[model samples]
Target: MTGWLVRDAVAGGLAGAIVGGAPSTLHALLTGRDPLAASYAAGRMVLPSEQRPARLLAAAVLAHGALSLGWAVPIAAATPPRRAALFGAAAGLAVAALDLGVVGRRIPAIRALPQGAQVADHVAYGVVVALVCARRRVRRG
Candidate 1:
């Protein structure tokens, strides 16, 4: 269990960096910074999906969902009831964007695409990660 948590933390944090930092990369590139700067600056490897296998990806998924729960619950609790739903919605979208855009292999072209396409990509990442993590928990039996 201890080993799992440690691996999950590293995997998830790296995954989070990938997801959250994509925008930083885009921001850098749009402003004329080295495109590879984001890749090295964050201490993240940014490896290709083909290089990662099912279980490692599953660990990453679990880590992301755990991070999402940590963010969402607190925001919901802190916001006013009337505004809680909106807050949750925005948080969910932000999580999806971070996870999908950088961590789950979405490209910056999302900003160029239709809004629905962007939403779909992020939502897909969230949903798949949720499913993979759930399956992993069951498999640990």
Candidate 2:
């Protein structure tokens, strides 16, 4: 049970890193903002001019990745593999609600994101996590 959970988490985290980061990064790039800097803003980290770009980017990715892996556990445990993506969509909305309605109010960094962008990024997170988890289960089974 422990090993299974660990494997699932690792898979989810990897998928989340790619899925969650890509759209947000693209949005930032298209808008002329540095993605890493935006991440730092979301995290409420003070981005001093002296901070190394690589370190800031890593911090951002790590933050989003951690949340993705955590959310994956519930979906993996409760949802059927075939329907995981559907549940993932729901999960994404839940995340959006929590982030936009609750966490965002408390965290200025999160609130900094345009509401529409936040929703899209979260949906991407859920869909990717579901797909990756389902694929991993199919391969193993």
Candidate 3:
């Protein structure tokens, strides 16, 4: 049980990071904004005054990965085998509300991001996490 849970979290986290980031990344590219703006902002949470691009990028990846994995745990645990997508979507919206509406309001960097893109990214993350959990359950059974 523990092993499967870990597997679900890891798989979902990794997949979610990629799929979840798409909307904001694409939005930034299309708008001629920095595609990594959100990443850089996340990095700033740790190194607030750092200016080196390489260091910021590294920090961003680490922060994002950690956050993805952290969020996946609860999401994976709560998601039901049936109606996983619907559960995931609702969970995503809740996450977005907390992450964007509440937490983002406190962090200037995060608060500055495009709300629509961020919300979409979070929703994507939740959906991917839930789907991964559901798929693993099916495979195991």
Best by TM-score: 3
Q: Give the poorly placed runs of model 3, Cα more than 4 Å off.
A: none
Q: How far in Å is the alpha carbon of 90 misplaced in model 3?
A: 1.4
**Which has the better TM-score: candidate 2, or candidate 3?**
3
Model 3 vs. true fold: TM: 0.94
- What's the number of clashes in each of the models? 0, 0, 0
Winner by TM-score between candidate 3 and candidate 1: 3
Candidate 1 lands at a TM-score of 0.32
What's the best-to-worst order under TM-score? 3, 2, 1
Estimate TM-scores for all models.
0.32, 0.78, 0.94
lDDT tens digits by residue: candidate 1, 1-141: 255434433443334334543544455557776544433322222232323344434544555355544543333233332433344346547765664466535433223333443354333333333333333334554
Judged by lDDT, which candidate is best? 3
User: What is the descending lDDT order?
Assistant: 3, 2, 1
RMSD for all candidates, in order, please: 12.1, 3.1, 1.3
